[model samples]
Target chain A: MSEIVVTHVPHKRSIPFGQEAVGALSIIALGAIGYFLYPDDLAFLTRLIGIAFLVLSLDLVTGYCGVATLGHAAQFGVGAYAAGIACVRGITDPVALLAVGVFAGTIMGLISGALITRFRGLPQLVLSIAVGQLVAALANKLSWLTGGSDGLSGITPGKVFGIFNFDMYSRTAFLFSLGVLVIVFVLLQRFVRSPFGLMCRGIKDDDLRARMIGVSIYPRLVVMYGVAGAVAGIGGALTAISTGVVGLDSVSFERSAEVLVMLVLGGAGHLWGALAGTVIFMIFEHIVAAANPFHWMTLVGLLLILIVVFAPRGLIEPVLSLASRFKRKGEAA
Target chain B: MTNLLEARGVSCSFGGLHVTRDVNFKLTAGDRVALIGPNGAGKTTLVNLITGDIAPSEGQFFMGGDEITGLSIPDRVRRGLVRTFQTTRLFANLTVADNVALAIMQRKRITRRFFSSSTELPEVRAEWSEILSHLGLAKLAYRKVVELAYGQQRLIELAIGLALHPKVLLLDEPAAGVPHDEAPKILEAINRLPSDIAVLMIEHDMDLVFKFARRVLVLAAGRLIFEGSPDEVTADHEVRRAYLGSYADARRAT
Candidate 1:
């Protein structure tokens, strides 16, 4: 499976020489630099990494597959809750929590994807919101197990390979989360370039034409949705493991909406946009909230409006186009 | 002999209005057939029923004598019954080559590989070249569908269906928007299709219909009015009254 090859498509690239490799390096560099630069705020940065994972997952279905969802946080919450429950049940391995979280997310994704992929437009949005709310309601009503409104506490995870412990500063957690993000992002880059990923883009572009050429739309979409769920689940598990807590707010509607906003801000289809949007939004939230908690949300709302008005294709497209234009000119010269 | 693709007593209605009425049709292996009718003549509706885009309220479909009455559009395509739309249906944002590549990938059923791009596949490359060169679309291969002119897009549309390797192809107005000068590339592409594969083109252009189709079927207001060789069809008085009036007038006027 390891061979040196080139990819023609821009949305997907796995080679170590191109933008994919550069992006991978950047994420690692960010995590390392952030850990050193903001040792005190490592926890916040790690959480942003986790949120970035969730937005990456959303980008799979919403950006590439053209699915409209505002309830992706349901997958994240389920993953977090699953990881949290595993920890509560005496499975404290960091690796174990991540696995359980991913499994739970994938299963939730498959089921919800089946439901969500069945409808379009208004019904789709309703189904997404309905599913998220239902999960939130279930989590709230089942207080005896989930710790309900109080949130799940005592989610103590054992250290990395029994060496690194998740300390007060969360340095280990940041590295672990960064490691996971790198791995997942690499895998995603490979996937969106794959023939299957191309088909998903094809379906997103013109489902009827996709069908005209013998693509079974529903099943493929279902699988895509499920995969998205798995990614979000990983995000959830990271959140639970790093913080050692799982809250009802993890699966709340606002969580889903926030990720959507993050995806839009950075650009939805491109994986790197997930990182850009998440980092920008989280830093903005921290800065504004610290300055004035009430006005921070208003600032965020205005920022989203500005982005929609000026850079409708999201922040990445313009930058990428400009970079490519310069490169083309350089090549010509 | 078993027909390659058959539609028997097929009928469909939208709410209370009948769109297609008891349309019985057949295509043997390698026959060149055409379907022509006035606007709203239920030509496309019949094609949809055959392709299983929508199910017929009455009657059945057969592909090589096997029951495919309830099959979905993609499944019908998988069975080698492929079609192009009346209006172009293409991946507007994707390159023309990728558009053709997507169809070839779907046809090869190798669209699920997670590590490699489909364009890198030898099979995909081979098919992509053949289809593009055949339609004279090689120059426009790298250009996105949205950037191409309407005529170029129509040619690309035919190239996509051709990439599917249809056992029986139903082309809906393949030359509808194409100018006369550029229409031959489309005709050449159709002419270059394998002799064993059957073709049924739906066209309003009698010149194209006569030039490409050895046999023709005329539909009017959702009924099969005439089915015969091209010369016989053009000479028939009934066809003249219902559909050929304009074409015949244009010819006489010229």
Candidate 2:
């Protein structure tokens, strides 16, 4: 008993760091693979990074905090529009554009989160969808600013840090997105393991208990939504910067639904799970759509069913279990 | 001295069914009061009212002379008014240590620190380590709450309530579902609680109530019927009638 206690006590402080190191390494390795394997299709990979940020943001609220939201794309879209508008208005520095996206996403997250977090379960989900549709409608109505259905275009962001021009081939754009993904991933790894993140998980599991433990559920949730929005904003800004266009599709309900699918596909709560799900789902979609553009949705639906049936916790659970099992065996040897 | 917790004419009703009627009680520092009554006697309802789970339709609650009728549940808790549920409500997926650490974090107001790691915080680690060890739960600290036995989970619940540093701790059946053999350990832990903090336990377990509580409060039909020492409680006509064949007859047999 004493031995077990001794061994476990110190393990907590050290274990997550090892997991983080692996997460960072895998992200870098995957980014390199995308760069080398599909040099001509860097734009697609950049788009994946943008969506990855949205999914990660969703995981913070929906996965960790257990808030049901189907309108997360509102944050992503708001970020995209914010960046695009800033660029068209002469604030085209890529880094500055990303900050603008973050700010926009945070504000949108707080507003929508405040309204949505007031309820629970079904009402929350409905409120999220409503908020998403409302944003989409507003964007469509404000045609002069948002370009309505045509999307806000003619965005040509300046070179990153006065170097590494975003060329027509999208090489610089891909690297920039990947770089942002890595930085965000690292920071978020720390963020989620922090005390705030742990409290959110507690609230997610049992909010009544959290309230009893002296947690102001609404305010914490609103703040978390703000954080999640900021991350989603980064994703949106990346999309605007890399693609040089802000489309109505960016904030569409369909986009929100698809990103949610990606999040659940990889897994929800784990940060790495969010990244893995995005990569797998997006890559799978790209391949399937290319193979059969007319019936691609059917294929995606089938894949979702299979995944839900088999890996209900998402694909990351089994992989993580196997990894832990292997580590125990290694230690025994 | 001002009472640690005081409920003055506290009443609650769900539409027409009054659950707690004109309920009044006082608990000062180092109180070991047992609230026992038949099922649906408004015992849990009273606990809920005090913990701010359900607001009293009438009357006010005071903590150290401050009226707290409109305070939120968390606000009441922040003022050192904590509770343990009849059925254990823990973070089932979290490790036992994390479960306790969360309350500690809430108390220390470090739950908002997003950049630093929770596990590596030396202050928190020291606090929870001492708490778990003191409760004889050191071995199980790393285990998830779901993995623990029901009795152990109840102890974790107590651990969490303690972590809140409560002045008035309301425990609703801390040993309701524990195995007969393991119930004593929970009682021992409860008995070992800090001497200064007042504890009011609502329990149907006669033996536990008799052993742990110096004073007993009996309720029937949502109203306080009697309040006195354990010996006086067993002899009181209303208390004996409230327990009927169970507690009163058991005392007679013993």
Candidate number achieving the greatest DockQ relative to the actual structure: 2
Tens-place lDDT per residue, model 1, B1-254, is 66998888988998999988888889998899999998999999888888888888999999988999988888889999999998999999888888999998888879878778566576787778766765667666767799899989998888888888899999999999888899987887788788988999999888889789989999998989999998788778899899998776666577
TM-score of chain A of each: 0.94, 0.95
Report DockQ per prediction, comma-separated.
Answer: 0.51, 0.59
Give the TM-score, chain B only, in order for the candidates: 0.95, 0.97
What value does DockQ give for candidate 2? 0.59
Model 1 C-alpha lDDT per residue in residues A1-333, reported as the tens digit of each score: 123232333222234437568768988888888988889999899899889889999999999999999889999999999999999999999998999999999999998999999998899999999999999999898998899999999999998889998899888999999999998888888888789998999899999899999999999999998889999999999999999889999999999999999989999788877778888889998999999987888998899899999999889889888996896588569
For model 1, what is the alpha-carbon lDDT of residue B46?
88
Error of 1 at A138 (Å): 1.2
The TM-score of candidate 2 is 0.97
lDDT by residue for model 2 (A210-324), tens: 9999999999999999999999999999999999899999999999998899989999999988988998999999999999999999998999999999999999999988997
Global Cα RMSD, each model: 4.4, 2.3
Candidate 1: deviation at residue A168, Å?
A: 0.9
| TM-score, per-candidate, Cα-based | 0.95, 0.97
Q: Write down the lDDT that model 2 would get.
A: 0.91
